[model samples]
Target chain A: MNDLGWIDAALTAARPQAVSALLRYFRDLDTAEEAFQEACLRALKTWPQNGPPRDPAAWLIMVGRNAALDEARRKKKQTELPEDDVLSDLDDAESALAERLDGAHYRDDILRLLFICCHPDLPAVQQIALALRIVSGLSVKEIARAFLVSESAMEQRITRAKRRVAAADVPFEAPGAPERAERLGAVAAMIYLLFNEGYSASGGSVQVRVPLCEEAIRLARLLLRLFPAEPEIMGLAALLLLQHARAKARLDGEGNIVLLEDQDRGLWDRELIAEGLALLEKALRHQRPGPYQVQAAIAGVHAHAAQPEDTDWAEIEQLYGALERHQPSPVVTLNRAVAVSKVRGPAAALAMIEPLAQPLAGYFHYFGVKGWLLKELGRADEARTAFDRAIALANTPAEAEQIRQHLDRLKEGAQRKSGRGSAHPAQS
Target chain B: MLYAILCYHDEAEVGSWPKEKDDAVLAKRALVTDKLAAKGRLGPVVRLMPTTAATTVRAGREPLVIDGPFAETKEQLLGFYIVDCASLAEAIEAAKGMVKDGGGAMEIRPLRLFRPGTTAGALAAESVAP
Candidate 1:
């Protein structure tokens, strides 16, 4: 408690709960934020000398509510101050909540706090910004740096998002089961979007924003805490963990993209792998297979294999099939084709993705995979054409460079042969 | 021997709980503590702040600071209890009694106490007693 670092952490850990409870009191985002800040300021002054409160959130809530009410009264606002007995009732409620409130109610409070930030009315960027600002307690400057935007712009964006949430009149009452599930789905998707915002940055123009990924993980963990029994939430957390476990090995020191098969397995974070596997196993036991669970299971298989040669591509292909059944998409099939190439022959894989040409024409990975399959089949000219199109469609310089490597191989294969080509250029 | 029983749990839910709910949890655990206290075996019990509020200082060739607990364990260490135990088996038994139903682990470690100011060079001359 005497340590400033500890105080900082305690305040951060207490933010969602204190702010949400304050929101319950004031029913306004700005007011709740101001009150929580005030409480934190007071904690800094008092806690170092006296030691931490038994329950930091509860202490902050009581103090914040009083501070807000006092300010309102001092300003002589018409905001009806509850009678003195009402104050006692507030204390009674806080002190006797074991008899009044169950774990589910508090869970909803936190969920509602998170769900409000990700209202459907908000755009994807705004939703991510708001969640980082409110739920994760990221400073505007910190978030701006992560997203590569100006601090003022990020602050304005968060402010606008919060205003939109308030204008949407999102009901604060504990939602019905169906509505709660719907809100949870939206929240989960928003978190995934946040993670992808960071995870998708492959260096170059957009520097890899690891903090965004870390913050997204923290938000997922917080959501898991609120809904421990939800298997999909478990899968969601597991997926992020397993994917992030390979973060260090995903790119080389030269900032070139490293394919999963080419990655150094020893660089992967084993602790995260173990935690992810534990969560995935627990989720699978629930028998409620969702998209996230299937994806996590795929990552799980990759994690279980120590070496690329030991990879169970067959299981990965099957999982992708199940994923398609759950949520059909051409992109998913394109990903599955790469696995098909590893398990079956290149011809089989090429035939599989032949139909995806129109649907995935604009997708970079589609052409990249097509080129790889064509190269494996010793179709030099066709592989070169596919590699050319892939380079054109690549999102980053690193992506373009990978395709360029394939094109270079095609050129070498053509040069060494007197005629066009026979087959198996690499083998020869 | 003295054993330090560390409690690890997912503190996101516990830390954010309201006063009465937090009290109810502690009181229920007090049921286990009461027996130990009666036997004069319990030394001290502490409930710590969540890991979010933690900071780590690395004492390498050059001092460095980092945010968060930097703990490698899956669950965060939420609290601890010091108790007098006859043997490692006794410490394990004490730990099992303290573990409430949840997703966490209890690690019991043998400890030594050093009273720095008791003598000119007070090493482990006097151990903590309850």
Candidate 2:
């Protein structure tokens, strides 16, 4: 194979195992990261000429481990360096390492690595930054661009996080069963953050950060594999799959924000939806409801609908209620209010969200949803007020436009309802 | 080749250790060191003073020049051991026995080694640490 193809294949195949092994070898985040980069450079130079290896991950890990060891030895000036052939023979060495690193090893290294990056000690922003940097192989520049922050700032943030990990002296071992269960919640939250970071990509002509989304989904799947019996993990994976199923329909020809109601159902990825729904059904069958499962059930309700109007808003509202009990937050309540408006009339949703005005004041989505509910209730003044707040807090032009459309519709509805005495003229 | 298992203990616990127990604690550590020596694992082991005798320096800005360790931490670095181990896993396993029940925590960290040559060689290696 050509160099590019070979490099891509090697990276794709070896990434999980190599990273896992490096985490095992170095224990320090920065050292492990540096070691991996060294191994990759060697692979690029040698792999194309030698063709692909049998066990790419193992090959990369072995080469990287030896390289790290070699560098360490050279640092101490302790002994002569090993021969090149030994370092380059990754294909043979990887199989040996793979045998040694089976089930427990996989958990201790890769999954635990995920858990470490999302350690509760690190701030959420730092958690996402560290995960993107260490796990996804994204450079600080790439992560900075994705975050729309300065490269130097992002670099400093990542460095500070690594130092925290080092200073905190977080365990390098795979935590025991009790510890794993406790920390799993934090890990799942981090993965979802990764997905949302990509899912909620701000303005500009670019599409979503497909890799981040894909990697988050991939991590979720890996987590499911580890905890096949855990309903929440299953629900989380299902939720992402279902949400991503609509990726194609999420944008129009002009790359604008297509509301859930406006999206073309036909364009949705049925394969993803089916897989998502199946996983959701399996999770629900466990009869052990949790936040992720409830949210997944809500998504499942939407996925089952043939048209937007066919949505089971009553069930969705119920699922949202269960979700609130499991993991209540202002955001969940705001979303549930939308379902409330669809099922119990706009007045009910308006009542549901009225108490949330204080906490959700600065949140754009809160006002946007509130505006829609008020507009539905024929309360044009309050609806416009909410819409204005939403527009003011809008993160992008697209979000602003979506809120503006609601305000326009509200004014038009008022004008039609009040006949010729309407104070405000509706504008297109 | 050299790994450090830095022991972090509660300062209150260390403060309460009776003066009569000092030599006994040292004797216990000496026993542990002797056992490690038999297995060719011992390198350097030292018991540090309480966190009161520690200093911290940040990379930038006028150093806060704190009198004590980083913070009013319940866990303070009590002691450390440098062990020669083949791998990180080995080092961690070796460090596990260093802590007594409800006494302290040990942090096993591998020392970094930067070489004059091919240090750059490892830079782009893509060795992922999980």
Candidate 3:
């Protein structure tokens, strides 16, 4: 690997521990971040010459702490700071901190930092923005592009989140078991949002933003390590893996959206699917079924089917029913309707979602599904109207193109009928 | 660290409880508080009257006085406890003890001493030793 490539990987891996440990020392987000940046600058200068340190995280934490102190001292003294060479040599302090960085301390520091970023006082948007900026270390401009917002707006949002967190007075110490359990739900939700931010790809090329998905998976794995026996966490990790396994087949050659049933199954990642299935099996055995477990069970069912025709639609429908009971919402009902259509028929599925029309009027998938069901039932006029609505609500060009394809099929069918009518006027 | 555990319960359900039932719940809370006191984690406990007795002040070009809680939710804040603990887990454990059998939820928020212009050097030196 190239020198800078290895340095990048080392920096990304060391970020959580180094930044968290520095946060522990500094007790301020901005200070901790500035210290981390200074340490990184030092590493960029020294690692190329001295080779990498034995423990990059420990070295960064020690060096970052001292660098921040040096800055404070420099500001107080109003004199020249120390030379780069003097600051970069840290053989003794690095090993000393490495000795003190025990497993419990490391886990708690990382968890504490995550909890601070996802503090309950902040709104969901702010939580996501802060976590992306602090934990994943995404640049403000990149995050702004992902969310389709101005960089200044995202910067303001992150600053406001930090201010709220500091004002809320999050504890600096390691959380206890009960507190960890309490915070797990919020943390899980944040991770899911992170994954969705990458998975949805509402704007821009999805291939370029797939790193968010990988980062989210890494965070979920870290959470799984902390709560190994927690079934919901296992289910969550499994769910993301199963969904992401199909990423390669999610679009066609021209980048048009491909429905799950039409996608090439061979393109799916078998390793990720295998890992997800194993986790789902373990989670189901735990029997403490929650929303995540139910959703994972549904995804597991889909993954197990080698071909679309072999899918157990009945089981998927039942799982969605269980999910609906566990977490009742209009969106959940709309999803369950898809399984309903597969198990029963279009008529039954249409009736199932008829009551959801008012609530899901603005929902894109609702109209798309309604249009498909209408088309199946030979209700051409209503189907066309629904497809039009779906196109209007589409969030991406691919989504709109999917609906337009349906409209094109409808037009073709109409033209064939009219041409047959011209040939056989008595039958018409 | 200090945390305030705010208890929320459906007002209508709480209002319908019998006197003896209410007394039993309060008795359970007292037991938890006594245990916390023994552990030297107990802090000030405040039990507020219902939202009906609340008055809200809104400032604008003309100050407006509004009656009742800030927002109408099914659950209303009924009481609170400030507890001293080493971590959030301890505070949550303490809060659980109070609301074990009570049909309500508690929210734990860490209390901050807002000190502006505080440098990190002093805190770092005090907390970390080489």
Q: Report per-candidate DockQ.
A: 0.05, 0.01, 0.01
Candidate 1 per-residue lDDT over residues A1-428, each given as its tens digit: 11255566667777887787777656778888889989999999998787667667777887887787677666544655555432443453443234123456666777888889878778888899898888777889998887778999998898888888999877867799998898899899998999888877533445346778777777787777667667898899889888888888877888766777778888887767766776777777678999999999999888888877787989999999999999899988877887787788678989999999999889888888888778777777888888888888877787787678667767776556424222221110
Question: Each model's fnat?
Answer: 0.06, 0.00, 0.00
Model 2 segments beyond 4 Å from truth?
A78-101, A202-208, A416-428, B1-130
lDDT of 3 by residue, A231-346 (tens): 89888988888888888887788887777777788888776676677667667766799998898788888787777778798998899899989999988887788777777877
Please give the range of 10 consecutive residues that has the lowest summed lDDT in model 2 chain A. A419-428
Which pairs clash in model 1?
A: A9-B52, A9-B53, A10-B53
lDDT of residue A342 for candidate 2? 75
lDDT of 1: 0.74
Once superposed on the true structure, which residue ranges of model 1 sit more than 4 Å away at CA? A77-102, A202-204, A412-428, B2-4, B8-10, B13-130
TM-score of each: 0.74, 0.69, 0.68
* CAPRI tier for the interface of model 3: incorrect
What stretches of model 3 exceed 4 Å from their correct place?
A: A79-101, A120-123, A203-208, A414-428, B1-130
